[model samples]
Target: MFFSFVLCCLCLSVYADTDAVKSVSVMEGDSVSLESNIPEIHQNYIIKWTFGHPENRIAQINKEAGIFETYNDVLDGRFRDRLKLDHQTGSLTITNTTGTDSGDYQITIIGGKKITYRFSVTVYAPLPVPIIIRDSSHCSSSSLSSSSSSSCSLLCSAVNVGHVTLSWYKGNSLLSSISVSDLSISLSLPLEVEHQDKNTYSCVINNPIRNQTTHLDFSQLCQPCAIRGCDSAEAVIRLVVTVLVGSAAAAAVAVLVYDIRIRKAELETIQTSHRPCTHCS
Candidate 1:
């Protein structure tokens, strides 16, 4: 009995290996197909497909009865008008896939032999092209690291992205990267390069299936020209302050001269009065 039990366990393990679950991935708004992996289907065979739970039957086919149907009204009609079944291989296809469409799917076939297949589907939204912008937070003139202004600080951002990696590449080399698995989250990465870097650089956002990239324009976002705006703003403020100071000084000088003239006139009148006027004499 023990020998028989061991043999049964081995057989089950072999079957499990043969029926291992498959993973499928597709971009949102795209179509994806699932294969039954069955070479041929004989007459009187029945094939059934389900999603999430086995009770949620999505598609089915009965060869003997000549019946092929899809449950478009099931599961809140999430699969309405989006399910397709292959008459030959019993494969299933879903059109205009979305992130909500990702889940576990099962297939059961009954003929001379019973067979099962499981699938895990994932649908990712198209990746947003990473945006590279100058990062002045740590690159201002007051920054100790920016005193010489030898390098430029930059940031790469991807907004509303899910299941992706954001990376900075320098001349086909990865400088830095960060990965995210949450749904529709914003992420950013930082990079620093020489102000006059001649090597090419790119920011890329990618998921398992697709990627989007944006090239860096050295003169457009780097140092030297990058901080000119900040510097120009400071220069304008200084110019205004200098003009105001000059005007105030000029006004003060005018007031002093007027006071001196008034005092001199008063003194002259006093001296004339004290001298005993010629008319009085």
Candidate 2:
């Protein structure tokens, strides 16, 4: 009978350990509130709160003993001013969340036995206003021809953005994107030569917390003079000239060496003929 009792106790302990509640979610701005249903077995237990992925206990409340303990090192400063414990409900509230406040959190209960609960918190900041700047040098479409291509780039500026996504759009469709703490830049794309009369480009910056956009008209973009097959022809002509000059130089050097060798041979034959013949009678 004693053996059976020990077995049942062991089973109960295992079940209690697995019954701990855990919840995690992202909170907006600088505050977060969490609530969980407490089991009857946990009524007499002490609730402990912790931060980090594995849930290191940072603060605790002893319900029966009416005692509270906190670890300042584990709790972030931004959370320190805003962290509050509801002793009655065993819930946790955090305010004034900052970028550094994003992380995992946990709650542990200590009573006749020990039970643990865990949660994760994420904080977000709003997107900043986007600024549009014209890039005239790279914005020229007239520089492009049937045999040539031209590129144009535009600048988008913003500030104080946190975890926000930036994108470029032509109408409702996305074109390109670049992310920055304050702004989002767009990459240079091919501009239509005929579309220079139309204004149809914009920058879109967004985050879960906020969003902003900037627009560009055709006049703000670059327009270069169009030349028919000028770029390709110029490149081909330059290459051909380089090759021809190199070949001419080589031919000139070969001709000079050949002339020098022929002259040396002729002089040697003339000297030999001018020498007195030993067999002359």
Candidate 3:
């Protein structure tokens, strides 16, 4: 019983060592070669590859002829026309790749003993073109009264990559930002008005497979305040003053006309009194 227990421990150690497999990373639309140092045997050996999980079989190698056999029902439609395997080299090639093709891959070697290899594949598409836009609006009156607070926002997007992170910088100083699972990133910045703060802003996006960056000049991002309440107040004051002056002028003319009519009546009465004396003569 003691000898049997020692032998069992030894077997377990060997099994654990052989179970260790190296992971491989490959880009989209690239070819990957898989080679193993396992001893070559006369007996027929079967090689199988699966994506994500061992249950999701992608392709299997023929034991006798050493050719790759694929199952149409299990294979994904996007990888239908794109996948190719070399029987002799045991290499797999994936032609154009989409974001959904990125996942874990497993390779199984079945012969006298079963050997397994794990591979991690990541596919990256081109980065999306970036665009920069600027807006200057005040949040409160106190901010404007103290000094002009210039605000701006930056937008960045990519084509076929997922789980992206975006960061913003103004002459090396980081600004506020937002990110999503989609390929787009947006950042909002509120900068104090200063001579040195007139530097350009930059937006950077990154993923496990690829990275991209964009820069925008400060001149393009500096926009004046759109709602100028101070200008509107000046216009209202001018309108009120014009209306008051017109009203005062009309009142003065009416008082002068009343005084003139009273003077004319008094002069007519005195002239009538002098005419009565002439009638009596």
Candidate 4:
């Protein structure tokens, strides 16, 4: 009996790894068709498609009667509306897939012998637009040198991502990339870049189905002087001079307002003094 049990386990392992098993990946809200390894179905054969464990059947086909049925309450859910079975080939199609639909799917074909085919289906959400932030939190103008001024640091981040890659790119060239194989988590990548005008940098977040890139314009983010072809020191001096000139103008205006107020008060006093003939009249 032990030997028989061991043989059964081996056979099951072999079946699990058979070429009959297929792996499929799809984006959320998309449709996927899981083709049966069996090229042809006989009238006498019964085809069943199941999810998770073998007994949790989701769909079944009766070739002789040319009918397919989807079970409700199998996992307290139903695939009847979105599930389709190709009776001739015993293939299954699921439409408008969701992340919850990712799991092991198995098909059992019972004819003169029972054959099982499995599929590993994965559904991924569309990646959101990654955020690119310039890290000026630690940078200072007083500590900056020519070499330090030529470069800038930035961070790219995405939230609640799984089985995807977050990559940093300078034009078409890849600079860095990171991925977490299993659990969904917030991911981030830091990048240091030497300022260059001709090439644009970008952060790309992608899965198998879709990708989004956030483009970086260096002239806008890094060098304020490079945009105008002016010296950085000259730009600072010009800014200081502009502020001083504005302050001086404001002070001069204040003095003129004070002088006007004083002259009006003096004119009122002179008019009052000249009109003191009220008692005499």
Choose the strongest candidate by lDDT. Answer: 1
- Local error of candidate 2 at residue 91 (angstroms): 2.0
Alpha carbon lDDT of residue 21, candidate 3?
51
Which 10 residues in a row give candidate 2 its minimum summed lDDT?
183-192
Candidate 1 error regions (>4 Å): 1-19, 143-148, 225-227, 231-281
Off by over 4 Å in 3: 1-44, 139-146, 149-161, 170-200, 223-281
State in Å the error of residue 67, model 2.
3.6
* TM-score to true structure, per model: 0.75, 0.52, 0.56, 0.69
Tens-digit lDDT track for model 2 on 1-281? 56654553453465454444444434356567665345232335667777776666766887667775655555444455567766666677776666676777777666555656556565666555677654444323454543323444456666655556667777787767665443223332222333343546777777555577777655544333243333356566888999999999999999999999999999999999899999989
TM-score: which candidate is best? 1
Q: After superposition, how far is residue 60 of candidate 1 from its true place, in Å?
A: 0.7
1-281 per-residue lDDT for model 4 (tens digits) = 56654554444445454455577999989999998666566666788888986458888888788767877667657564788888667889999998888999988877656778888999998788999876664244543644565667788999988898999997899999998767569999998777665777899999877899999867556663244333455657889999999999999999999999999999999998888575574
In the range 1-281, model 3's lDDT, one tens digit per residue, is 56654553443335434455555545556555444333332225677777775458777886577466765566546467666766554555666676667777676766545767766666655556455554323423445444454443334433444465666777678775545665433333333334236576677666555667778765545443334444345556878998999889999999999999999999999898777455454
Superior by lDDT: candidate 2 or candidate 3: 2
State each model's CA lDDT, in order.
0.82, 0.60, 0.58, 0.78
Q: Model 4 reaches what TM-score against the true structure? A: 0.69
Kindly list the per-residue Cα lDDT of model 1 for residues 62-179, writing each as its tens digit: 9889888999888889999999998887889999998889999988877645678889999999877788888766555455345546777889999998889999998899998999
Worst 10 residues of 4 by lDDT: 224-233
| Clash pairs for candidate 3 | 128-158
